[model samples]
Target: MNTKRLSNQGGESQHQMTARFTNKVVLVTGGGSGIGRSTALAFAREGATVVAAGRREEPLAETVKLIEARGGQGSAIVADVTRGDDVVRLVETVVARHGGLHIAFNNAGVLGTPQRIGDVDEATWSEVIAINLTGVWLSMKHEIAHMSRNGGGAIINMASIFGVHKSAPMYGAYAATKAAVSALTRTAAREYIAQGIRINAVSPGPIEAPMSLRPGETEAQRAERYRETVPLGRIGLAEEVAAAVLWLASPESSFIVGHDLVIDGGVTI
Candidate 1:
């Protein structure tokens, strides 16, 4: 098994992380940065051959480079989840190159312009729904088709705390899409579990990422907001969220299905 010490993403410094995904092939979307990058590295450190996919190649390449530096194996694939053709090709390429896909983290998403429901532009609304909602569906559509017939797999869709419990007024577009993702996760889980494809979701709030910060807000302001809102008194780390994704994708969560695991520092509690 491949072992490595992961750092820089909020964790115990340079501790050895054992392999939990030996001989598995994992695919991570939106893996160029933030939570996606962290999850991709985690998978690699745990002995999975990771394929990091995103619309951009540079950031994905950086993710691969980090994984390699940690003595893990990874590769970058450029694909936009918002496009059906891209998603299809993305899945095919991963399987073709890696032999088979045993796990997937559909984490690609966008935070559309935050505005009052009535004031949000059509373009912004459409983009949010397309990338955040439709994109996940497209990813599952292909992944399910592949995993069902290829001995099954685990799929973790990235949801949000906004969808599971609370929502601010201007976050309508993003919130709606996330809520839909939760519903979609349940529906897909029911449809695919019999075939051995275990589907689940991870709903996070105020993680260390650009999307969690509000417009015109500084990092300090965002930190203060989390203190007021999150019961844990701080924003979550990408590595923390990545740990949840890895659990959902691992055999440790074998009986878990259609569950939306919320990692919001007790904000929803």
Candidate 2:
């Protein structure tokens, strides 16, 4: 059991030691910022040669820089998760660069503008579904293909507590995609577990990430709202979410399969 904390932000990340993922090849999508960035750095700290992917190259580069600053090895790749060809190439590139992809965190996602189902625009709905639901599927498609052929691997997809246990009025579209992600994760886990591919999801709520803040809402306001809304009296940290991802990707969770771990600070309870 690896007990090393892998949080990558605030003041606590200065300490480092490699454990569960040493010499492993890990891939993180949406790794340009927030949970993705934190998770990528955490994996690197564990001795995994991480590949951070996002649509933007600049953020990806910065994530790599942070990993290097921590004496960890990582690289950045700009690839949109919504495109199948790009996903295929992303997996190929990781395998070609680091030998093989042993772990993958499909954390890329988008939250369209909040609107009632009757008032939401079609384009917004489509984009959210494309990036959130379809994107995860595409990533797993290529990732499982490579991992199954080479050896067993672990996957962690990003979902939301809203999608799994509750529903919000303006967040219907976003929640739908996340619910689909949870369903897809369970189905895929069953399909590929026999082949040594373990699949799971992390469904978080009101984390310290861009997606948690409402439009025009400041961090202070969001914090206060979390106090009132969440049973834990606070929002979750991106590093906290990252730690969950790292655990799911590690052998520590070898017996856990098809489980959508909720890290929502009791929001569902």
Candidate 3:
């Protein structure tokens, strides 16, 4: 009986150990800047070969450079998440190059034109949903298909705190899309858990990123506003959010599925 118990414990120990993603293949969408860029770099540092996709060529190149500088392997693919053809090709190229995909971060999104619900035009709403919601679905569709072929993998969707709560006025379209992301994350997790695929989300509050601030907002004004609003008394940095993403991707979170890891500096508290 003691020998049998020891064998069982050893099996559990093997599952719990965390070399995690060594030699795994990871793909991150919107990986050119902000949280996406940071996530890609973090994955590379952890010994995963990365495929970073984005709309712009320059930022993708820069991310690839950073990964290579650290003696890690990564490639940049120029693709817009909103375009179905681009997304399909992006997944295909990654699988062809790496033989299999072990992790996918569907982090591409857009805030869209801020306006009141009644004032939001059809074009504006469509644009926001297309990129923020529909694009994520497309990425999942392809990634799941690929992962299914090779046993399974993990997927992390980038949501926002607004996904769980209401935003101020004029953020109708953006907030709605994020809320949809949360629902989709849970749905996918349930659909694929039995197949060795894990799906989860990361909802960040107001991280310091180029896209978070408005075009004409002064630095001081933005800083003062965030200081007053956030419970932590300061805004979060992109690297902090990336850390959460890395945790979800690693085996340390193997038992955690369908959960939204909220990183808001205690603002929601």
Candidate 4:
């Protein structure tokens, strides 16, 4: 089938002629910024009706506007991932408005405050778990419910290299939550594949997003540090991670399931 050619923000080169996500409805959690926003736009670029779900409305709206500007369909839904009711409604609303949900990126997460494992406060720990771990779980639960009954769909949860491959000082809560996301994605993939719901995850390392910077650390400092640590000698881009997510969501990765593909620059190696 022929695909429509569209212009990007920077007058960049064109996308591939094949529209892999044509007629697909995609839901991306935490679509306000970073990887979430990038993935949402990527889906839209490929002809998907994208829904950006997040707790805040402003950023989500911004993401939708960016999607629309590119001649792709986009919408924003404000919903807290930690609440089951909100998550259920988020999924239902997507279906209600778009007709069906074909892909979901459970990417809502947070890097909690820096603190040693023993020195971490309860509130911070709970908040991290609620948003990162519990949030992904709730999203998959409702998303699977809709996909399994209506036919199959794809899901990509956001994990991290910190938990899947490497860990560091003062990141106990963040690491724990990401590790759980990896495990949950693997297990859920097995349980739901028979029902036609494909699930996988991407554990990205330091990237060109605010989340990659340490508290009070400057961009130059983080870049210099990654130059020494990451084999790629630089920070990863949100678009890079978004490319991996789109591949997983597409039929290209049909045979792969329960795999937590690490997108780090050989940090584990």
Residue-pair clashes, model 4:
0
For all predicted structures, in order, the TM-scores are: 0.94, 0.95, 0.90, 0.94
**Total backbone clashes of candidate 1, pairs 3 or more residues apart or in separate chains:** 0
TM-score-better candidate, 2 vs 3: 2
Task: List residue ranges in candidate 4 displaced over 4 A.
Answer: 1-11, 14-18
Candidate 2 yields a Cα-based lDDT of: 0.89
Residue pairs with backbone overlap in model 4:
none
Expressed as tens digits, the lDDT of each residue in 1-269 for candidate 2 is 11123322534544375766888999999999999998998898888899999999999999999899888899998999999999989999999888999999999998888789999888899999999999999999999999899878999999988787788779889999999999999999999999999999999887988888888999889889998988888778888899899999887888999999999889888
Q: What ranges in model 1 sit over 4 Å off? A: 1-17
Question: What are the clashing pairs of model 3?
Answer: none
Better of 1 and 3 by TM-score: 1
**How many steric overlaps are in each model, in order?**
0, 0, 0, 0
- Candidate that beats the other on TM-score, 1 or 2, i.e. the better one: 2
Question: Against the true structure, candidate 4 has what lDDT?
Answer: 0.89
> Lowest-lDDT window of 10 residues in candidate 4?
1-10
Candidate lDDT (C-alpha), each: 0.89, 0.89, 0.84, 0.89
